[model samples]
Target chain A: MKEHLFEYLLRLGDDSLILGHRVSEWCGHGPILEEDIALTNISLDLIGQATSLLKYAGEVEGKGRDEDQLAFLRLEHDYKNCLLVEQLNGDFGMTIMRQFLFDAYRLPLFEALIHSSDSQLAAIAEKSLKETKYHYRHSAEWVIRLGDGTEESHERIQKAVNSLFKYHVDLFFTNHVDDALLKEGIVPEMKAIHNKWMESVKNVFSEATLEIPSNNWEQSGGRLGRHSEHLGLLLAEMQYMQRAYPNMEW
Target chain B: MSKNDWPLWEVFIRSKQGLNHKHVGSLRAADAEMAIENARDVYTRRSEGISIWVIESNNVYASDPSDMDSLFEPSQTKVYRHPTFYVVPDGISHM
Candidate 1:
């Protein structure tokens, strides 16, 4: 039970950590000054959520490791984030599309998790849900703006939707770890969250004049520790300071 | 500076429950909703506000700098407005 819970915590933590890092790349590069600040704020919020979850996971594992160690020292294959999050940020439209999809999924997931039988998980969900609400709104609004804005914006955003949808199913990937946690009421049902995700996506996309690709293709791997080559590249940059400095602190 | 087509909005934040929404800063957003969200990211990241209001910068009309003295000079001598002669009951701490 502890092992399954710990694995589940890593799943939650890694998603936030990786997506946080991915969005942090936009800190200085957002389309405008206000948007730059907004993206970085979202990044900080995700990283903060990751910190709490990883810290709890460390305690659950009864490891000497702390949140910093779990975050900055983990190997590429050890990360459990879904493939959607680890994908590269191609453009502002692409970034917003990616965030919209994830935020749509995350908001409902956290809302359901707030009722978890696990007291600490419920508490974390309650706190993180507030921040995720804003994130979802921000991204969803951007999706509408970009998708309906201009001929160029429409094309770019549509391309983003088409390309990124291939990884959408990976968001619902679950395994024995999820099974055990579900049995114990420590997590929410993935099926319900998936339905909610689809509904939210349909609403936002229709409003944005965007469409999910008709193809039902899917991809998976992050849950079982296998990851794209991109993870290795991302980890190298993320872990560089810690690897080189050997536990140095600012 | 306006970096993109989005219009600039002036942000006002109420720091606490009973406070007035005070002008903090400005940012560019596509519309009013984005303006409010942008203000949240820019001005309230440190729990600096409980509420926010945003208006387009274009909609605000400001007094000319040359009129500063004319607009304000009369108030300088109006010390009666300060209520310095009032005797207060001691229990009113905020006053």
Candidate 2:
């Protein structure tokens, strides 16, 4: 039970950590100065959430590992995040689409997790839910603006939606670990969350004048330890400082 | 890409619940909603405010610098309008 719980916690923690890293890539590179600052602020919120979650996961594992160790020392394949987060930040439109999809899923996931049988998980979810609400609004508003904006923005964002939509399924993937947690009431049912997520995506896409891709195929496996090539490159950059100087502290 | 510049907005922040909103700075945004969100990210990252108000910069009316003396010179001579004539009691430190 503890092991399954640990894996589940890692899945949650890694999602925030990796997505935080991806969003931080836009720190100085956003399309505009205001957006640059906004994306960076969102990145800070995600990394902060990751720190809290990974720290708690360490406590549950009863290992000597701490947040920094867990974050920086893990192998590329050791991460348990959904593949959606690891997707590259292609362009401003693509980045917004990626963030919107993740935020839509995360908002409800956190809302449900706030009632977890595990008190610590519930507390973390409560704190994170407030931040996720704002994130969802910001990203969703951008999606609407760009998708319904000029011809070029509409075309570019539509392409982004089609390319990124396939990764959304990975977020709700369930296996033995999720089954155990569900049986014990540590988490909510994925089916309900999935339905809610689909409704959100459909409503927003309708407003944005975008269409969901007809293809039902999905690319997954990050939760099972198989990742795309992007994760390797991302880790190399993220872990550089810690890897160079073991146990170094500012 | 749209060639037009995004509109500029002036940001005002209320540092605490009871405090008045004070002008902080300005930034460019596509609309009022984006302006508020941008103000939040740019100004309130340090937990500096409890509320934010953003107004389009173009909507603000400012007095010209050339009219500074004409606009303010009358107030300088109106000492009666000042409350300096009153003396506070020793027990009332704030007054």
Candidate 3:
């Protein structure tokens, strides 16, 4: 049970940490200065969540490992972030689509987790829910605007949606860690979370006049430390400082 | 580049409930709502404000530079317009 919990938290933490790194790459290169700031703000918030989750995972593992060690020292096979998050941030449209999809899942997942039997998990959920709400809204709004605005925007955002749809299945995979959490009442059923996520996405897409792709070949493997090709470069950049200067602190 | 570019907006913030909104800085955004959000990210990451306002930079009309002396300097000597002439009751605790 403890091992499963540790793995579960590591999965969540890696998702945040990797996505935060991807988003942070937009810090100075966003489509606009305001979006640059917004993306960075979201990045910082996700990284903060990652730190807390990773720290808690370390405590649960009864290891001397801390957030920095978990984040910087973890090899490719050790990370459990989803391939959706680790995918390249190809463009503004792609970034928004990915954010909207993940935030859709995360908002409801966090909302349900607020009632977990684990007190610390509940507390983390409570803190994260507020930030996740804003992130969901922000990305959902962009999806609408880009999908419905100009012809060029519509085409690009539609392409993004089509390209990313295949990764949706991995989000709801109920494995051993999920089963244990379910039995312990620590994690809500993924089916419920998936239904809510789908409804939310559908409503937003309908309003945006965007079509939901029918692709069903969902990708998985992040939970088992498998990832797309982009994560190594991302890790190289993110871990540079900590790797170069061990135990460095600001 | 043209498709990627969004309009620029000036950000204003009210630090607390009763405070008036004041201009803090500028950012680029696609629209007013995003401008407000960007303003929050740029200006209030450290709890700097309780409220935000974002306006297109072009929408704002400023006092002419030539009128700066007449418009602002005349107020400096108007300190007599200040309420120092009146004395408050000693028991006026809130004042």
Which clashing pairs does model 2 show? none
Clashing pairs in 1: none
Off by over 4 Å in 2: B1-3, B87-91
* Candidate 1 vs candidate 3, lDDT winner: 1
iRMSD for every model: 1.8, 2.1, 1.9
Misplaced by over 4 Å in model 1 are B1-4, B68-70, B74-95
- Candidate 1 lDDT by residue in tens digits, B1-95: 45667788999999999889999988888899888988888899889999999999989999999999999999999999998889998888887
- Model 1 residue A214 CA deviation (Å) reads 1.3
lDDT of 2 by residue, A1-108 (tens): 988898999999999999999999998898888889899989989999999999999988988889999999999989999998999999999999999999999999
Q: What is candidate 1's lDDT per residue for A208-236, written digit by digit as tens?
A: 99988989888888888888888888889
Residue pairs with backbone overlap in model 3: none
Off by over 4 Å in 3: A240-250, B1-8, B57-95
TM-score of each: 0.93, 0.96, 0.89
For the predicted complex of model 3, DockQ is 0.55
Residue A61, candidate 2: alpha-carbon lDDT: 93
Ordering by DockQ: 2, 1, 3
Per-candidate alpha-carbon RMSD to the true structure: 2.4, 1.5, 2.8
| DockQ of predicted candidate 2 | 0.65
- In candidate 3, residue A25 scores what lDDT? 88
